[model samples]
Target: MQNGRKQIAVWDVFVRLFHWCLLAAVLISFYTTKTDGAPFLFPIEVHAQAGYIIIGLLIFRVIWGVLGPTYARFSTFVYGPKNTASYAKALLKRQEPRYASHNPLGGWMVVLLLLSLSFQAVSGLFLSDDIFFQGPLYGLLGRDVSGELASLHALNSDLLLILIGIHLVGIVVHALLGEHLVPAMVTGIKRFTSAPVDEKPAYRTKYRLLAIGAFLVAAGVCGWLWFYPY
Candidate 1:
């Protein structure tokens, strides 16, 4: 603790690692799918692999949101509609209260982003380019249905870009409001200017093994789903 503030461990190692890995996977997926050629000698298969990675990460996150530490739990950040609206109003007035994890509006944004990504990844599994490339589960769904899902996947990709832009803007706003959110995510420590006297976040980084186990289980499921049809 320093400068009239206290530092609390908020994001755990698994959360931070998952966040950055997901970002990397998303970037790879976007580049491979959106461009004619990928950098770093990456092949088109990287796109599907990245989607698989995103699915695995999302699955692990869902489990972690239920069983992780206090600050990492969904209950800590996902607020009700009334509380979300109140937070939104305060945010517009630039007087929203500080939160150790995501703010109310940001929490909902996270949910939307997750849902969008899940759709994109799942739909891509049924896509076919009619060329050298075909998704793993392409034959499972008939051509007409898979073709329709491919179109929706492209549209959702655009929506994801919009959501990502808004997230970046929110990061900028947080920086202007004197909150270094990125660093906290990277370091797993959030500094509070004036923490509640009666309440302190409980440290629970000891669950690192549990986090790993969750990710392994998620990965195993995704692996079977990806390769079982082959």
Candidate 2:
């Protein structure tokens, strides 16, 4: 409540941490796998480790989206085709309304990113470099199937870069439209001069402990896959 604006806690602690941690993991994965002549210190093993971290993060996020606070749920942000189209039209006309959670188009982007990253991580589990590195489930699918997944994994990495580019461009476009979107994600608090009409009461559920519990479960599962591989 500064200067007549209402400040609300939109992203929870787990969500904020998840967002940044995922970003870092993605970057590390890409740098280790995609870049040529990269540091010898960061080998393909680092890439595999980052993929495991991403798998754990995505698992926790799916759980949180189901059971976390009001604004964190998929129901709050995932709009349908008509709504997304309408929001796109509004955006082109510069008439889109501000949203406390993700705007309609942004919601779909989040879904796409999640799905894409999930595929990337899961596919990596079947990949191998004949000489030194092998994913946990590298030989489970047989060489032929693993080879196909390896190809898809490479293709999807390009798609991921494209999607990430669009995401960054969207942030810049929002900034140009007078909405500073990144800061809210960083702080987990969003401020508005007038609460958006669609904005719901924030933090209606006590999910902090539940979120932590969910992450531990996710991490344990991913850890088992990382260690056991069978």
Candidate 3:
């Protein structure tokens, strides 16, 4: 608490960990895929491993969205189409409200990012480059079908890159408007100019075991799926 404001814990430890871990995995996968085993000391297999890890992370995120803390839950932030449009209009006019959780536009952005990444990961499962690598599900489909899925995987990767650029731009815009979003994401605490009296205190971060269990389950599933075909 400082300067007539109050500090509230908005993100829990699991949420913060997921955010950073996903970011690192996505960046590593992107770099490895783009370079195609060149310019990096690590083998290209790291790229496929990163993609598998991302699938696990996505599974964890979906479960967390259902059972995680207040602000981390989808019900707490997702808004309807009309409400999102209104918020976008307000944002364009520089009159948007300060939300304790994710704002309407940001909430939808989160959904889009998740969906896009999910598509990319699922498609990657069927992709085969015919040389050095083959996805786990490649043999489950015909060559033609797998080839199409590989194309879709590449296309969606580009789309994800574009979405990532937009996400960064939004962060910069919010920062310029005096919102310290990055810090809040990092520290799990949000500082408000004047705390809302009606806002309930955040639930305690007591789901450490649940998060770890979910991660282990997700990792196990990924591992089995990756190796079972061989």
Best by lDDT: 2
Model 1, 72-136: lDDT tens per residue? Answer: 77888889999999989988998888887888888999989999999999898898777655887
How well does each candidate superpose onto the true structure, as a TM-score? 0.92, 0.94, 0.92
Clashes, model 2: 0
- Candidate 2: deviation at residue 3, Å? 0.9
- Which prediction has the highest TM-score against the true structure? 2
lDDT of 1: 0.84
Candidate 3 collision pairs: none
Cα RMSD of all models vs. native, in order, equals 2.1, 1.6, 2.0
Error of 3 at 69 (Å): 0.6
TM-score of 1: 0.92
- Per-residue lDDT tens digits of candidate 2, residues 1-230? 89998888888778899999999999998888767626756478778888999999999999999988888899999998998899999999998888989999888889999999999999998988887678888888799999999899999999999999999999999888877788988998888888774688778546768987998999997897678643
The superposed Cα distance between candidate 1 and the true structure at residue 139, in angstroms, equals 3.0
For model 2, the stretches where C-alpha displacement exceeds 4 angstroms are 37-42
lDDT of 2 at 70: 81
- lDDT per prediction? 0.84, 0.87, 0.83
Model 3 ranges off by over 4 Å: 36-42, 196-198, 225-229
